[model samples]
Target: MTFDKNSFSLAGKVALITGGARGIGQFYSIALSKYGADIFVVSASQKGWEDTTQKVEANGQKVAFLQQDITNPDAADDIVAAAVAEFGHLDILINNAGVQLRNDVLDFKDEDWRSVIDVNLNGLYYLSHAAAKVMAKQQHGKIINIGSMQSYRAGKRIFPYTASKHAVMGLTKAYADALAPYHIQVNGLAPGYISTEMTKPLQEDPVRGPEIAAHIPSGDWGQPEQLMGPMVFLASEASDYVTGVMLPVDGGYLLR
Candidate 1:
């Protein structure tokens, strides 16, 4: 078999990334643009959008920034419409928007649990559902769902986060099966203990921090940059035949 490097080029493609502003999301916006995809970033807040825009423009890519909460059911269609209007078509969708909360399973408040599920699960479904309609018409698209280490196993003080991620894996497979015939690929990317602003609390924790590092075979937390390659592969034609798979970019943390 022959491998073609050109298959990985995302030139002339349009990607809509949710939560494509701060932390790890910033890396995704930059990485995808670097590989030649125009970006439509939908962030909950406009805080870091200017920085993300500069990074994307530096790579010679066009990017549109939108500030809206995805948790609202009606916000999905509007978000997709805005992206389509900006870029004309949506070729790839990175479902990178999510939230996490820490609480003892027994002490987890109803509101906190619902909040996590709202953004992590419900909001994801809303946007993916909207994107699916547009992509189905074109008979081609890629959807990458961002998952977590808790997607495979349990995490301390984060039961709701764990529960929502498990559901994301299920939705990934279900969407893949439903959209495969249309040439739409749906997949999940699970990151393990990546060091980022959102994960700072865990990374700096005196107890949970070192405990997590010890579990990873690499013996350290993963960096946001490490996830960039896998994201590009999935978004580009390189993963055209891959679907319904949850790829972990962890440093062998699950091996133990």
Candidate 2:
């Protein structure tokens, strides 16, 4: 039997990406669109929607936008419905929206911790659950959760974000196991020492910056564009046999 040479082609597919209006999520939207998938971007703010729209359109693919915060569990259903309405069906869901807070273990406030978990873990679950329902009925879907190196290791003053990511790892596995029979693939993408706007402070740290760079065998932080290829693989038919796997595009940052 011949295998599909075009397995990576996402033509005619549609993706709903949370936080797709900016940062890494914006890159996700553009990458998928570049690879022939129509994009339905969802975000809490419209700050970057215009730029995202222009990029997606420049790729010659359809693009739609929705302003909805993923943190509202009740709105998850509506978000799913709107995506389906906009594109007829949802083929991929990228749970890339997240939040981070830093404080000493003792100084970390109760609400501060909750805010991190609320967006990173709880919101991801609500949206994934809603998207899985649609995929279950359609008999196929891809859910990519954004995880971090913290999923495997912990650091100071960031316990809440770490906790959320660790839970995200487990949730990815659980969702994979449960959705496999439905032809839905769930996976995690963990980034290590990625140089993005979100991590600008860490990159600029006089002491902490060099410390992390030295530890990364690659001798540098990863860029958002470096992740696009992996994202396309996970979202396309190329990865039909791959599920529950966490792909790291960290430029060997985890090796050290």
Candidate 3:
């Protein structure tokens, strides 16, 4: 067999990205489109998708938008069906939708804990399961679950978020092992402290911001765009042999 230089090209493919309207999800959507994949963006709301749609279209790729709360039990089926209906098939699935709540463990409410788990862990599994069926039928696909720094280490005041992220890594491995026979690759992208809307408060904190940066060997927070290369590689044929791994795009934060 010969290595194709264009293995990273997503031409003629279709990708479904959850929480794709803003933040890191937006970058993932744009990056995949730039590599020649049509995009299907699923978010909690459609209010901010216009820009994402425009950007994907600007890349000469078609895009479809869907608004649904991933926490809803039926959302997985609906999201998968909608993407397939819009594009005729689904080639890549990015489980990027997530939620985080910060509170001391003693003060954390039960509802808040459940909510975080619902969106971050349970919802991702449901969606991945639904997409896996479709990909199995086609005998090829990529599933990239969005993990976080918390996936590997515990963080103060974010117990639920940390737990959910840790579960994501496990899900990636379990799904990868089970789905390997079907030619579907299951993996994860664990991002470090990126400057996204969700993390704006921490980034703008006069003291916390610099303190966090100092810990990172890179000496700065990661920009959303920095994730583009890793996203494209995992979503495309360039990573056909890779599965069940969590690739950290953390600007060397993990090294410390």
Top lDDT hit: 3
lDDT of each: 0.92, 0.91, 0.93
Lowest-scoring 10 consecutive residues by lDDT in candidate 1? 1-10
Candidate 1: where are CA atoms >4 Å away?
1-3
User: Candidate 2 at 246: error in angstroms?
Assistant: 1.2
lDDT tens digits by residue: candidate 3, 59-145 = 999999988998886999999999999999999999999988888878989999999999999999999999999999999999999
* Candidate 2 wrongly placed segments (more than 4 Å): 1-4
Candidate 2 per-residue lDDT over residues 44-148, each given as its tens digit: 889898899899999999999888877775889999999999889999999999888889988889999888999999999999999999999999999999999
The superposed Cα distance between candidate 3 and the true structure at residue 228, in angstroms, equals 0.5
Q: On residues 1-256, what C-alpha lDDT tens digit does candidate 1 reach at each position? A: 2469888899999999998888888899899999999999998889888888889999999999998999876999999999999989999999998888887768889999999999999999989999999999999999999998889997779888999999999999999999999999999999988887767987889998899889999798989999999999999888999999999999998899
Error of 3 at 212 (Å): 1.1
State TM-scores per candidate: 0.97, 0.97, 0.97
CA error at residue 223 for candidate 1, angstroms: 0.9
Query: Residue-pair clashes per candidate, as listed?
Result: 0, 0, 0
lDDT of 1: 0.92
Clash count (model 3, backbone only): 0
